[model samples]
Target: MYTELNSILNTTPDSFTQGEFILVSDRQSDASFLMHHFLSFYLRARCKVCFLGLVQSFSHYNAVGQRLGVSLVQAKEKGQLIFFEGLKESLSVLISQESNTKSQAIDFLRDPSVGLRSLYEFVRCTVSSSSGGGEKGADGAEEWGPPVLLVDDLSVLLSLGVTVGTVLDFSHYCRATVCSQLQGNMVMLTRCDGEEEADDGDDEGSERLHRGLTHQCSLTLHVQGLPTGYCRDIHGQVEVCWRRRQGDGQHTQKKLFQYKVHDKGASFFARGTSSAVL
Candidate 1:
């Protein structure tokens, strides 16, 4: 596929083409490659590009926003201008950009427009800031915007001109936000299955002991330091449990697992999958 795409790209003598440009990013780094390619194509095409695919890092968005002088606050103020009012406006913007021969389509696919709208709804639904519709208290104090995800206290965000609305919107779809704990702690676990055989088998009693179970499970933990602002080592772990064969001719078991997160790396041991609090 790479070779074929390259060949087609090389065959196009004209730098700018009228047809739609589609780029697929299979992984996070692929997104970076896509950005690099779009910039290269944009130079030749000189067209406004509508980005698609996942913008993995807020850093990427910040980089682009800095280039365009568009911050979260600015986006809110220039909402309709940048992202269009809704999906209709978003599609309209893309179509308009597509019409320009010099424009390049750089669609990053988080559905930013949709994400923003959902966030707006969540704010109205959850927190009662401006987006939520409820006014401030009698003292004129207002509820601060979205909670910040940081390794340390994020008072800086407030001074950085980040509003509750912007923070609420940003954190809505952030996986890190969902898993993170107070004081910047986080734990991530994945479930896996494996099979094993008993040492004794063949005998009726042994056969019962050696009967192979088709389904087995294990858990892997990916732990990182809280709010480091980068993927860094962390040190922390809590008890975990696993259960199997519960009720109605099913086996059941549970265990405790501990893990630690450090700046340089992390460590863990496999344990059964039962719910546990550490």
Candidate 2:
């Protein structure tokens, strides 16, 4: 793992500049370790990078928190702060890497060392709202909870007890309502057909869902556990089909994909090529 970290660190900044953030969607066999080592390397290298993970710091705090002087509540806030700080620093690295925001982000992750530098910055600056006045809300409505937009393979917009008119509505709600406010977004989706044999005869149904979504959704983020040849065409608002792969015993659930939509269409992106089309 360290060897891989070294190789990642050795990568040229340009290599990172060419790609977007790679959000690790599924937690594979060594997913946690992979993240741990990747982050350790990034921290050691002082790389600037962002991490999209489930908000589970409270459990860590509750387990061994008495060691710190702060109360459990305070400790929890501190943890959240740490998370946001890391994100901001990664954002900074994204800004500094190149002339454009997107370009620098590519560089920040190109090399493990540079990427770590960014990640460390993010961790250092983030402060949890529990610490103080952190996450803001609309009309003091209490910072909106993470906005969840559930979509099905049939491209049917699954209602999370709500209805969103267009793809942009979903993005804006997720962004302004949640990601921007909470600093993170959560997503869950079913894998493509044949990846895991559908217990029922839903292969054709799921494929239909996936293809039907191509027109309405403009963003597609690539992450772990997805089949090969998967690609999204947000610029043209099209979905590019790729060859399929069988599941290799990975948990593709509970993964989140951060997305942004523009006037032209929806552009899907995540920590990596793992896409989430809007």
Instruction: Using TM-score, give the best candidate's number.
Output: 2
Give the per-residue lDDT digits (tens) of candidate 2, residues 172-274: 3333323344443322232343443443554334344434333233223333433333334322111222121124453232324322333222234443543
Off by over 4 Å in 1: 1-8, 11-14, 27-31, 52-278
Model 1 local distance difference test score: 0.27
Per residue, candidate 1 scores C-alpha lDDT tens digits across 1-278 of: 12222332342313322222121211111123223333323322222221221223334444544443334334334221112122333354456654444212222113333323443343222222222322445665333322211111111222334343443334333223222321111111111112224323333221121121111121111122222233222222222222233433634333333333222222443332212322
* CA RMSD of each candidate after superposition: 22.9, 19.9
